[model samples]
Target: MTDMRNGSVTLLEVAPRDGFQSIDKLIPTAEKIAIVEDLLSAGVSRMELGSFVSPKAIPQMADMKEIAAHFKGREGCRMSVLVPNGKGASLALEAGYPDLVFVVSVSETHNRANVNQSVAQSLDQLRAIVAEAGDGGSRLRVDLATSFDCPFTGDVPLDAVRKVAGEALVIAPAAEFALCDTTGRADPMTVAHRFEAVMREAPDETVWAFHGHDTFGMGVANALYAYSAGVTIIEGAAAGLGGCPFAPGATGNTATEDLQFAFEQGGITTGIDRAKLLDTADRIAALPGGKTASHLRIVPRGRAV
Candidate 1:
């Protein structure tokens, strides 16, 4: 049975990382900082501010180091960065950010396409990262990419996802876990089932997160379902600006504003100001060449537009 617990949820604002990385045009570092400041002011307690990947691979994230430097050790906000491989994890640890997110695909094909490695190889990388983060902050997390559906292979089997997740738990037992719908093809039924079954496996885990995209317009619904299934952390990007550049046809992430609105309506506490979040969404949407898909950001705000 699903928990359906609606007391509260942590919303991880991911515009600075996931949302910005998808845009083609370069958003000046100053602008990026400004956006982060705005997000913080909106009472966003946690966020994914950047990634520790190669500059050549992702030009938008080339300034990740500087961004980390500026926000390093800030109290109150739990800022994390995507660390794909061992090298990235090493760099992040050296840069004073032992907290990291290591992503591995449940689908073999998408794993090879996203990080140019097999699933086993990615797990090996996770082991190395876990070892590096052994005694420190140990904020390591495994993002089970394509946990629900994969663009290349279509719907991924839940057993495959569980196998990979089990291996990941063995690699980093104390680390957090996030089930990612890489292609946004997941429906509420699958979301509920996957999280429930996985959560049952780790009854002690209270920090499981759900990362979904809005490709099929079920982003909010899927997230709410995950919440019911006992997920605590919900990842959303302002303006819904994000997609897997590696996953063909995938769209932006579940919008932060939409999630807040849906949960707030049910009296779910997120500690975010709706007006400020909407304002931040507007700023993100105005970015040149930035594709957005949040319904709240577009609708009339008292006919002010």
Candidate 2:
């Protein structure tokens, strides 16, 4: 059950869903499929393949069902989709995805802006989802967005984060939980403090995860801090392809290659082929209006593969 990199960190490739959704234009479904397949072939074992939100709201993910059907039985990769609400959850489950990521912001203002639901309403919906999924059926990963800071409101309190996460864990005790830096405004200290504190509140059965953005260029550092705080599952987008709707013109989620390079260098293996990962990233960044910003991609270093 062990491998080379000491406390190995697993990565969840989210470019297909998180990254592509940021681009204003709709990427062809075939291209989306190809990119996802390439990421898997590059040795990414976990991923956010797509989402089941209303196509009217996010035209980019309109073809999620088709994408799911294409890679239904693919081996060596665990893929999931973002489900905004009960309907999205039902649709994703019907499409054959048992791994579902349900997102809620700790900041009420951000929650309303992000999902049009108040924080309390989101918790109620999550309670329903946990009941529907049960203890052993669908795997639910609740993403507490804006855990560190909100786009509409600046800094979020640690107590508020713990409260929301506690409420969610109470609803889905066996489910995985992710603290997300939706605005990319988290410093390493806050990342560490929040994760360390929040982790203390969860049961031993809960799996901790970190989802960070790169808007302030602290994505990699924040992820490392989260990892040091005992989070194993880290989420990133290829070529840094996702941007928050609240922070326009800002960079996207943490880059997959950046994470791979950072973790591998720290003796924490990610199992991603560096060269192939970069090439895949390059191809994705080449898409029309595709936005990307990654340090390892720009600077040549000893780790360049």
lDDT of each: 0.87, 0.85
Tell me how many residue pairs clash in candidate 1.
0
Model 2, poorest ten-residue lDDT window? Answer: 1-10
lDDT over C-alpha atoms for residue 20 of model 1: 96
Model 2's alpha-carbon lDDT is 0.85
In angstroms, what RMSD does candidate 1 have relative to the true structure?
2.1
TM-score of 1: 0.95
Q: What TM-score does each of the candidates earn?
A: 0.95, 0.94
| Top candidate when judged by TM-score against the true structure | 1
Backbone clashes in model 1, listed as residue pairs: none
